[model samples]
Target: MGRWAVATERRRGEALIRAIHEAVLAEVVDAGLGQLTMEGIARRAATAKTVLYRRWATPFELLIDALGEAYPVEVPTPAADNLRTDLIAALTLLTDWMVTPAATAVMAITSERGRYPELAEALWDKVFDPRGGTFTTTVLRWYAARGRLDPARLTPITTQIGEALVFKLAIDNARTPSAEEVAAIVDEALLPALGL
Candidate 1:
């Protein structure tokens, strides 16, 4: 291809990718996962069905790509000096994410995981593990630097306490915890669990 032709093609490709991502989220939000289909996506995105087939082999692939593109996991900076403050900040960021439309997509994927084991593995490997892993590593490093991360006490279980609690509140109760609740989790649960 000529230089301008190559550039034009690249722009078109980028736009198609954006459209596909948007269509996936909109479809799930509007119609739920059951009604999400490749044909429907192509129609909503105003792209050729061949384009989607060329890029993604299955709805699982498309959905995973869209979710990853839409909700890039963000691990926040520590809030303040202490572990309590920092842990609360990290957990709070997670709480905020849990309530977003992107998280609704996540929940949908998770709910379907039992039926589609590969999809669950992909979601964890591609999306959840990277983001959650980074945050967990950051929290551990922060506490270790402060000489507060106890070797025996600060295991994966302890690290996940705050996040677990928040997720429990969101999943079991259908409510995101208040700031006070987050603080209580940090002060009463995470910090003590970490032996900090």
Candidate 2:
């Protein structure tokens, strides 16, 4: 193909790949990850099964891709004020994020992938790291700017808060992380992380 023709075809191919990803996400969201299959995804995406198999080797692989598509890091940055307030807002955002249907399912999937370190690593590298890292980076930044941040204080606070929120949601089956609880995390963990 000519240069222009090649570029056009490449773009079209990229669009098709994205469409297939979307179709898989829709299927998983509608029917859960177990319902996802190569043939099923091919039929839903109006593509060939072989094509999907080439892109992904297993249902889990495909599920991870779908999860990545659905749970991309789109959380907004919190407005600044002081460490406590900014972090509280950040933790609040994290709270809402955990309960999102996509995030919740992804967490469950990650938990299940405990045996497959490679898959778990991929999930963390692509999805979990970005989300968690953003918050960590944000907290650090907040402290750096204020010149009052302390890691000793901030670490425990954020850790406790995050652990509590996650444990409560996963084990306790809570719907939302309370504002008061988020504040506690910021006050406790986030403070020491800076300098306290």
lDDT for each residue of candidate 1 in 1-196, tens digit (9 for 90 to 100):
6987876553267787998888887777777878889998888987778889998998779989887776544443444256666676777777777766667887887788787788779887887676655344466666676656655676778767777888787677779998998888888887777665
Best by lDDT: 1
Please list the C-alpha lDDT of all candidates, in the order they appear. Answer: 0.74, 0.61
For each predicted model, how many residue pairs clash, with residues at least 3 apart or on different chains? 0, 25
Task: Give stretches of model 1 more than 4 Å off.
Answer: 1-15, 76-81, 132-137, 145-148, 171-173
Q: For model 1, what is the C-alpha lDDT against the true structure?
A: 0.74
Winner by TM-score: 1
* Candidate 1: Cα lDDT at 166: 83
Residue 53's lDDT within candidate 1 is 94
Clashing pairs in 1: none
Candidate 2, overall lDDT? 0.61
